[model samples]
Target chain A: MEITSDTHSQHISKQFNHELEELKTHLMAMGGLVEKQVQDAIEALLEGDSRLAERVRDNDKVVNDMQIKIDEECTRVLARRQPAASDLRLVLAVIRATSDLERIGDEASKIARNALSLVEAGRSPRGFVEVRHISEHVRKMVRDALTAFARFDTQLALSVVREDESVDSEYTTAMRSLMTFMMEDPRSISSILSVMWILRALERIGDHADNLAEYVIYLVKGLDIRHTDPDQLDDEAIQGKS
Target chain B: MEITSDTHSQHISKQFNHELEELKTHLMAMGGLVEKQVQDAIEALLEGDSRLAERVRDNDKVVNDMQIKIDEECTRVLARRQPAASDLRLVLAVIRATSDLERIGDEASKIARNALSLVEAGRSPRGFVEVRHISEHVRKMVRDALTAFARFDTQLALSVVREDESVDSEYTTAMRSLMTFMMEDPRSISSILSVMWILRALERIGDHADNLAEYVIYLVKGLDIRHTDPDQLDDEAIQGKS
Candidate 1:
């Protein structure tokens, strides 16, 4: 249950440690807001709540502002604290994670927009099953990615990475079925395409979550495992390849 | 065509300036590689050259490697040099731009994959015109965004941002037509769907380019212009509203 090294706590200045903690707290707040955005956007789509979808669309600005705010704070920390080693990585990781979180928010808004179109069309496509399934899957991945980040848990982060592969496969399966459905019923192509887009958004949300998890691994282990073979990632990264 | 401020050159230590210059060069190299990747991927899709598409897919690793390398250098610069103000912005911009460029590379690879699929399917569908048009448009935007970074030209960067809006509208128009085309000729549905994906990929490439341009503006003006209203971005950003 011991956190790895507790490096942040080892800083000589309590004020410096407090600043890093505050930076992370802000990042976690951003993560929380983005997660709610994704959840609300998906709920609006499934429940045909156009009103909720509109709110999700509007709330994307808040996520954007958070990214700007956190990035400014990171620059300030780097300028003032001149943090080295693990502290530096923590700031860099927050920068990268916020970027991913902001993109996740953008995708959530895109999903909400598609949901609005689908609602106005007033025809629920047959792929809501896939939508619901994948949304829940990716939302968990996002939540877990954040948790891994909060705890500096490489195991949980790796699990998020592994889950992304399954999410990709699920996306493929959903795409194939939807394509078949469209070819079977040409009249459904328009609405089905909108569903396809929403599915695509969810799949991308999963990807952003995957990126967040990778940042966690990078922060904890100092290994930039991005674009590495996922098969080799587990043994090497967790076992301290670097 | 004087570059703005020449703040990077103002650093007192010649060695530090050299390091910053070297980082910029590596980033430009990565930028050039990604631009070619997009260009080649679109050519493969248009000409049915699976060989070229395969090369583009494999070469994404170089782009990935460049991101990690550049990032490490940035971290070192931040940790060792503890660069403040404009020198700091230059490093941060390189970091952010590399991430955008890497994603742009990923999208190019996806386009190449879809290109391979389109070639194997043996049906070119009816959307090649739009493909050629949009690909050329976005390739120029990518080039301009990189040029903006190299020259510290916010004006060029803003132009790239404006071009993205047109590219997006072009994509929307193409999507509508392709949707209609599929509806009219159900037999073309499968090949046309692949074309749709390629178009989608191209649209996303433009988005990444837009992001790169935004980073340039941020580096030069210290303005976080992301998620801003595009219409107002010109007056506020260019007029030195930080």
Candidate 2:
């Protein structure tokens, strides 16, 4: 909710400030919606709630619509206000962030679809524990990434980038165990593959969350730290402001 | 290479036109690099050529660098020229296409990594046919999508969009057979899962190609046809130009 107004409040025209604030507000709403979609997706899978999963799948359109609207708004602001420096970065960040959020919504929908498939296939207990664990980790990462965007907190954004590494390792561990589980019980192959897809979706959601955090860093610090090592990110981000 | 200069050449300022043209050229180069990355990754997987796979992985950094540079150029154009209407859409489309191209690079790198794993584990021969088939299909999709972008031909773009559906179904068919192959011989589970990941990456490359084509439609006709059915896309695209 902060919207980085403390730093960006010096625009000469009230209209420009208002437009930027409105863009932030819309972005936050989109972020929150996708966050909930990710949550509901995991819950539906964990509890076998087909109804909730169906709703998650259906809501993807809503997320898609928000992305298109937000992108158009960004284009309009660029054309109208011609904001330079940090303002340009803000618009660019929003454009990139919305794309990531939409993909998160997509991954959530994938999870929901796999959840429905699992309902028909009957539950297998082998990989659900890993699913629950990784989902919770990624949900927090998504939440924190949005919070970083809202506050323009580079430190929080950096944390999310670091957290993605752990989530990835967790995914790999889960994947190995699931493969072994399927190998041990070949009859569970069909059901376990569904679970593997769900885990893959979750891992990808975490990657998207990582991307959102990187956008926040770029917006706040003027650094393009993508494809850089996470260990070096903190130093590079700090130097970026200088 | 065409760069869509036919329509956009009417700009008043030659410098602005040059900048836009440069952005397009950079985008095409990036597109070409990632397209080759996909092809080489597939070839490495099929041939079990570890050196080629390694080259594919290393070239991902070059792809990443191109994306960042192109994005910087886009932000520079938006700030300096403040291009409106079709020109603005061109910059926006380039920004988006670069992102997709970057991810396609990532997917190609993933395929390469899996290819290395397959080489280490020794080829299983079970899933190679599907891998080759889907990779050829998606490689063409990527090539055609880039060509559509370069030519600004909505018809070619639509064809790429339609081709993605077939690639997706082919993926599902491959996935089913691979799963059955694993259930038949649990000893092959590990290698088969690597192939599955490779297939998943290929399917995702097709999706990115679909996105690139959608951007062309958006760039040419100003239609936001994402999430719309492909069957109706042509009508909507034709009507969008009206």
Candidate 3:
């Protein structure tokens, strides 16, 4: 029934794709908000700004609303258009990427809550400067992942996927240092645990960003590259391109 | 074009719905696997079963495959049938629920890894019995969430959502105790931190379960109750029913 050749049919098809495009725009908007929230949530902790943390926390509802609206739009389009192959992949990718972005928003909220906890505990948390050092890598990973997804650049997506490993190693290093610090200084154990939790949240943000990049590869190549090692991904990329 | 009363059209529609039913059956099967993984992962921690922990970690690939396959089926159905309204809701819910299930699997893997870390750390890790008590509530929440989703029982979904609050309170209590224990005896800090991470994973599993129940409400009534407070959900659920 969708295999029509009429001019009217062609016009309708174009609008259908335009709807997919609109869906992407909404996804990017949501991505943009999540990106800002992550940045501010980390900064609020590193700088110990409860006021800024409160802002990040309150903006969570906006991100949640955008997620609902974007989901509704995706559902509407799937019902009306019934797109095939690549277009179908793109719509599915958008639905998934939106969920990842919303989760990124949730992680940001967690970071802010941890920040407020440290601030209200009436002492500046130790090793927050160290936490910032660790968070920078995750922040860049998130930014680059969003860029790759928007551009559909498999190369960039691949790079983001690879970056996740280094970020994960950095997480291990951070956790080790936190654990050591906790033992050596019992006076600061509570605050150190808070810092550890914040870093854990950042590490997870990197993970969600990594998952987002995988969706980009899946969108482009129509292959499941998840659970595959980054070293293997390089070979898979060559094969996919060839 | 789908708006037809002809016999052939009715037959095609029936086939489409059969596809949806098939998708549901697959989802339930995947849910069953994930549930077992969660149970085994926690037991690996509680009982210090390194062998079981490794098994849970290794089985992650199976869960990942199920998630990808289910997602592909949803995309195919959307591209072919373009189901509207309730049917559209059903497919979208399946896709979303599959992701949650996959995440639950990932968290299970994380828990398993934490268990191995404790086992390798060569310490039995105190406070684990307490951690088991906390995880019990989460495990039940997950079991009931899947039950509610597969049965399309909104009442059960509401209870799952309400149960999350108690699980959350237990998480807080457990965390506070863990922190106190860590500070009092720094010798066990390393193993204790791993236990804390496992407990954190359980709390998140509870959250994912809560999200699953929300999807049921979304599928049944087209209402987004994600950001709403549970106390208010009671009133909202009554309104949604009428």
Choose the strongest candidate by lDDT: 1
Return the TM-score for candidate 2, rounded to 2 decimals: 0.93
Runs in model 2 deviating more than 4 A are A1-12, A236-242, B1-12, B234-242
lDDT of 1 by residue, A1-242 (tens): 24534655565468899999999999999999999999999999999999999999999999999999999999999888889999999999999999999999999999999999999999989899999999999999999999999999888889899899999999999999999999999999999999999999999999999999999988988889998877777665474533
Q: Write the per-residue lDDT of candidate 3 for residues A1-242, one digit (tens) a residue.
A: 44555777889978887898898888888988999999999888877899999999999999999988998797777777767788878888888888888899998999999999998987875677667776788888888888887888888888889999988888888788888888889888888888888888888899899999998888888877877888876645533653
Error of 3 at A12 (Å): 2.3
lDDT accuracy of residue A194 in candidate 1: 94
Provide per-model DockQ scores.
0.72, 0.73, 0.71
CAPRI-wise, candidate 1 is: medium
Segments in model 3 whose C-alpha atoms lie over 4 Å from true places: A1-7, A234-242, B1-7, B234-242
Q: What local distance difference test score does each model get?
A: 0.92, 0.91, 0.87
Model 1 steric clash pairs: none
- For candidate 3, what is the lDDT? 0.87
What DockQ does model 3 achieve? 0.71
